[model samples]
Target: MIRIGIVYMATGYYCRFWKEFYISCETFFCIDAEKGYEVFTDSIELLKMNIPNVSFHAIKDKGWIINVSSKSDFICSISERLRQNYDYIYYLNGNFRCLKSIYSTEILPEEQNGYFAALSFQHNRYKSPNEYHYDRNKNSHAYIPFGKGKRYYQASFYGGRTDELLKFSEWSRNMINKDISNGIIARYQDESYLNCYLQDSEPLVLSDAYGYSDFTHYQGEYKAELINKNQYLGTSLLHARSLLPVSQVKLQGNLGDQMFGFAFYCYLKKFWRDGQRKTILSLLPEGRRTTDSLYGVFPIDITDDIKIVEQQCKNLPEKKIIKVTEKFSSVFYQVEDFNAPVVVFDGKWQCYQYAEACEDELRESFQFSLTHLSEQSKEILNKIRSCKCSVSVHVPANTADSYNILLQKIISDNYFERAMEQMRISLQCEPIFFFFRDECPVEELWEELFLISQCKHHIITNNSFSWWGAWLGKNTEKLVIAPKNWSFWKDTPDLLPTEWIKLPINIDKKQLNNIIGQQILKSQVTENIGLYNGKMGYVLFFFHCARFLNNIWYEEYAEELLSEIYEGIHWDLSISFSSGLCGIGWGIEYLVHHGFVAGCTDDILSELDKKVMEIDIRRIEDKSLEHGLKGITCYVSSRISSPRDIVSTLPFDPSYLNELKEACLRLNIKMTQLTSINDILKGIKTYYMKLHKGAPLWCELYCVIDKIEKM
Candidate 1:
């Protein structure tokens, strides 16, 4: 008979999320009658009451240090204590919910002395091998080994044979003790030590299927299967303690000892009350609008109109407003319960309503000014002001040709001429056409709006910016001309005011030149504003003490040497050590075989240097060549075998490397193929001196040279 035990701990606030985990686990175990399951926790009485059939073991507080470090120690101790009774022991974190029954057969191997662990989904933070550092002086609980690339296992769900687990626990405990004695802690408490231990141990690695955290949002094959079949699976962290804000969790008025319930209640009450009283206007910007495809409209900046809307709201006595600035979808999940009446101000509101709302105070607030203007800009402004009327034209470049044709029809309908004629008759000023084009400075554009506002008459486009500018203009007798159709798909009746003249969409193009008399010259005031594929070099430093030694002095020396070589030259430098586990060997082999200068061969280095010089000289003659030139160099330190073996060392499938090779060949890019420690004092000194001088010292030059010569 197989004996399996699931152990967890719940001390303080851990109980809140633990409830779900506990219930889920109990439900799963109850369905499987053949499996003998036992749960061990500090809250045994509570568990026994909640889950009647399951056996509960109460862990008495033995006055052990209660920190992240102590938590691991406690887990190890429990595993050790239960080793004799259970053949297979599984330790699950209190926050981990078992949605389905994970049979021992499914997870554990049939044979004994087998260890199992799952890779962490939170690979960016804890699993980054490059970022692993443990200093004795620092009071932290996380450690990452030097020069190791990110490959980590989550300690939340790890189990093995009773004897193997006990031994693993003991070894981890010893490491912790050593760290504690030296007044230091591992980077991630138990998780760090577990990773350190596993680096030297062979464990059965499980995919993210077994240990799915909240961060793993993508429903992979396993997760999809669980969902499709309506089966329950494991979920690691339902609620992350670090992410939850303290104020959000703090209890206000508690009905009982339940803090989470009380806090949630208080949160809902406060936000709901505030939401109920306010007239919530959700202004979805063009980027935020989800119905853009349905409407067949181009994106427009509604920032100015938003201000107008806010000003209009302020004028109304009963408009108790709460403006939600972001997209509705993003914030809806957070405050879904706060049921407020939402009004999306999509630029189809009545113009007179806005015009009447724009009081003296509103107009003053909407007025724009430029603190400084260039001479060319000043001259352009003068020319625009000299015109009897200013026109704002909207061309639908991003939309279909049909939309542009409609715009062209409006432009050719003698609209600008008629508007100018009207302005000349009324305001007795000559109208000058002004429109914003690409590369127009923002300040100058705002100034154009200000200039348009000053105009006695305006020819407006089917744009929110133009509408707002015309509305905000100081002219009392302004002739606001707008297109009949705001969009081809929809008729915008409320877009134009009764006072503003609406031009027909299909106006005659021949009648256009008659009213204007002369051709309106297009604005001549123009504003103009405006690592791969090259000779590469690789420096390989083969130092025997590269992996084992944590001496800061060597690191500092390496960094200095790298900086010196990298400062003046446009070389893309990478400093790596002779570490097999870090995949440096694989990187070097790929580089060397692909015709990249390894710096080991004098002939190759000289040729590369000559190419670099030639490129520099060519760049002086043709600036266009310099545009394509980029840094393409690297510093490699590892012993590499043949290209085939190097490619095999990658964690991924061998086919991926083949695809990579194919891609490199297609792109005409070279891959360089570039090891292990010897504690020779003379070799070490020589390597250090060579590194300090920024000189490449190849220990195994023949290996790469021989491979390259054959190629």
Candidate 2:
């Protein structure tokens, strides 16, 4: 017959859950005194009401402490009882209820096993220091530790075989009694002392079912438990912990917090004594760790209504079991072939933490190291860098602080004048300047870059998003520069193999104090800003568009022109009108009126459709009418699609397209979503004939003005 014992503190709160736990186990005896009779009676009543296998011993006036402090009393309680009668002993706490049922048929023969069993569970939610385990990877389970970064292999101890297990239990009892008599108690009481002293004592690392417990309140640690001792050796199909009986949970009033705390304490101690920590790598047969052997209990099946208990079994890990010390009442097994997943050492072994003495051999034998890159990552980075690009600059369109104010400031003329002066000094070799950020006063920034620096400025961005701005740029041949690595999520993996120069730096300090240094550089320099302006200077613009830069002003035609320029020069553009627009002259109505040649703007299509006199007919039977319409198209297209046009800086929300399209339909002016500059240029070619005949002189003069504007 298999014997199981539950040693509870008999605290008032754990009475109910304990009752449920008692009813779930088979041939189990409770170890609380008669004063704990209320809790004990509750268990007996629960057993009679539901489960019928387990029994309880209401010991009067016996205080058995099980913590980091009290080891001897715990050992004596078991040693004294096991010597009398009992084939197997399962230690359970007061607070936990069985999620499964244990039966006598599950016990393994004593001849086939040595001593321990461990159950694994689901690890953690995040990289929480208190819960995460380092070795827990894609294929393995995670275990939480006691203090910080400490973890223990969870198990439920079943002192199997009265003849063999009792011998160790007696010895464990004697040692504790001796310590008590001598008044010798270590800081870490029974569990800690037993755990520390049991180092070379018992045969450790036996495989079993997965057990779980809430260790935060009681021992202040999280752990797993073991239940199926007989099934640890070989039976793969039977790898499961018996479920606890739900009928055993007493549905009474609230079972106060203390009972919950103590009940969990009991569960923790039961596993601490019986379950041994072994790495998942060693437990697998032929080096294979599968989720099949592991099982979840506490959080899964345990509710306010269920009673859980352990199932006894004989299958154990195939390894040599060495008995360390023959002094404890509960004998621990030392398995030579396995290693503890985590080992807690007395301050003496500080440097050699996380790893055991034999870890070096394990690493050398397995040949494992951290892996960083994949083939896909290498391919993507290379593609982005190898493209020929004229522009590469970060845009500041994100609403970091005061997005409205920054947009206003960016569009201001004074800011552009100052920014232009800086750019004039900075651009020595690179002829093209790239711009990216939130939608800003693009015309103002463009005018300044063109007029002040006398160099072509290019804007590289996908919509108004700042992240898209930086990412869309494919100017690997051009100097790639940005404010800095501003995002915490962004990592500078050696992903981009090419070395692109970072431009946010001060160049003034490098100017030599003597004329000889200047003379040598001046003779070799073909182009210099000082040659025109006669001033030694440069500009370093920070890429962030936060609230601090809100003092700037918006230029008049900035938004209207920017939108047109974007449509003309780029392959993709989405036109939309909105009533709830903010900052500068950014209303949807104003943009639509300025952008009417491209698309119409209105809340309802009925309103704009009524206003449409006629579509600008590309071919009319009368040459004069056809010629007049073509001229208008040419003029509108050229001005709107000019590369210097300014547009709004608001970030593009991907979902805003439908409403924008609806607004365009209101005026019967269908908007064209251009994918590239080539499309708009093709549209320009269609209107070339009318432009030559209807307004030939003005169109020719306008083209000259466009050329002079750049100069």
Candidate 3:
């Protein structure tokens, strides 16, 4: 027996709309994650009404979201249902439409049994190597137009042996595990993976004109050829947007949840204007008009002003009948055959109405903002004197799709600031209040004028800390905002309904600031390399030994002091050893590769001299200093890869210090003559200490300082 299931999370508009469609299936089931008392009772009642020959099962578990992982305990229950001698199983997720019956003359009966047959519409940018391609233009882009004046739909189907499918399932689980570990899924990647296995099966590819019963509302002139079949032998796959014509049932109550209810009614009204009859075939009680169809019952009421709806029937040779019922609430239609010549009425409601509804919801959810009358910003200047300016900022925290949208919005907003100014003027306001969702750090947002505007003037943000800082001044009011269309926060408090300054939903911002801010904040919270106990212990041990070695005179033990200096400094020996392996030539190669100097001639010397001055390598002399004037000199310098390239080793710049003293005499360096001498002596002392460890000793300095008496 073929067992098919229509899985739904909860009762909503789509559920009620597809009631008859699900009932027509061989086997039907509903999976409710929440299992709320009201939803459970209603679902059980609905199941009992349709469950004579059909086997129905419901699992009340909160594992729907955990389906992405290869191992889902929920799948186990589903697998159990499949093992009960089900020859075929078709799983249809909610919010889907059945456009056409799966039976077609083009496919053979043998190919239709034992496996799954799914339909996919190709609009994705990422296409696989083996997928069919046709050329429109010479550009090799995915989903570009193929061939002349005609396009073909390419898809992979999976429907074969049950054992092979079970094997594919195991493989799919493994691939899911690998994908999770590597983080390699790029949108619809699971579908892509499924396509890979199905590719070898050489599945059927529909022409653009083929009849498909899947989702997203199939249109055009070819839909009639696929429907009105006596029986469907194969399963039809669809996207999540399909809606069907339900002539049998007249829907009432909150029509918001029904799939394309109002929108379909509008289309029916238009069809009625085109002289089409309203048909209903169900006698559902409590409504004005009763009607009946092939399977269920319905009632109708005509509400729109387009035309006075009239019920009609076209009796066919096969005893098929079309019934229409009309009243004040809604119109109902029903046909006798299981496969009726139904008009495709998908995608309900006007876009503007949807947008306005979202706007109103947003307004109710957020607070209002005050605009300064004198602000110079064009975006701010166009608001009415008393009217509030509302702007919403979006920050997609973890979702990549949201991130991409956010980046685009940020770029567009920055580009359109001038237009925003003109728009503000057009709106007749002195100042416009802008709202932002700040996800980025304030420190990294130097280039973001949006955030700067809030800091300097009248603006509000969802970033609570920054919002308070912006609203600190005593003279102005603040605004907070939230999204209008989405009420489920998905565990994010940032999206919750709270008192915030309201802003118009500007999807253009995309919430990039949130990402930048989080990154900056993360960096701030996680920085401390040498603070580890082991590292600190090593540092203290090295410091004590270095202090002990300073007591030795350099002239008496220059080689030993060099070793001590090497031991004293914590050299990152990994790089040092790597450098050592590459040898002296590697150091010169690095300098040359970096464009530091050219040629073998004294170019390197000149650059080194310039760097020496830039780094402030200096001289010093003082008896009170730890290392007194000795047979050693020191100079401050950065690391050099090779010792072979370095020629001169100088400590204190005695000549530069003497020159500075004379320059100070000429009213130059802000020091008394005696203080200048002391400064030079301090510099000499520093140079002497450094010479004990860092710099190569100058032979002349050792000779001169070594010749001096201890006095």
Q: Tens digit of lDDT per residue, candidate 2, span 133-192? A: 332212211211334342233223334444554554455555544443432322223333
Best-performing candidate as measured by TM-score: 1
Ranking by lDDT: 1, 3, 2
- In model 3, the number of clashes is 66
TM-scores of all predicted structures: 0.28, 0.22, 0.24
Residue 88 accuracy (lDDT) in model 3: 35
| Model 2 spans with C-alpha error above 4 angstroms | 1-9, 26-85, 101-156, 180-184, 196-198, 201-208, 214-711
Candidate topping lDDT: 1
| Candidate 3, poorest ten consecutive residues by summed lDDT | 32-41
Candidate 3 Cα errors over 4 Å, as ranges: 1-17, 23-50, 53-76, 93-116, 120-161, 181-186, 205-711
Q: Candidate 1, residues 1-711: lDDT per residue as tens digits?
A: 676666565543454445676567666632332333354445644555655435555654311122334554565655645765677666676556656665556667434324554444544444446554432223332444466434566767777766766676677777776665543435455777777666555566655666666455645633211121111222212122111111111211111111112223233334433212121222332424332111112222335334434543333333222233323211111444321122222212223443343354344434343545567767766776676555544232333333333345435636556655555565555555565432354334455445555655567665555665677666677777776654443334545677887764444424322211121121111110000110111122211112123334433443343333333232332211221111222233334554332433223233333333333222222111112211111112122233344334423234534553454455454444322221211233344445553111122221222222233
lDDT of 3: 0.30
Candidate 3 lDDT over 1-711, as tens digits, reads 233232333332223433544442222121211110111112554546554434444533212121223222233335554444344333333323334444433322245432445444433223543243432222211112332222223222222233334455566555655444432221232344455455445444433233344442555533212232122211121111111212333433222212123333433333333112232222222534321110111122343211211211222222222333331122223222223323222221222222222443322322223332124443433442334443323332332333223334433454234334534554444445444443344322211222333432333222322332232222234333322322111112222224432333233323423433333343233322121111211222222222333422222232332233234333232111111111112223333343332344234334333333332212323222122211111111112222335564332255654543443344323322221112323343345445553211121121112222111
Q: On a 0 to 1 TM-score scale, where does candidate 2 land against the true structure?
A: 0.22
- The CA lDDT at 638 in model 3 is 14
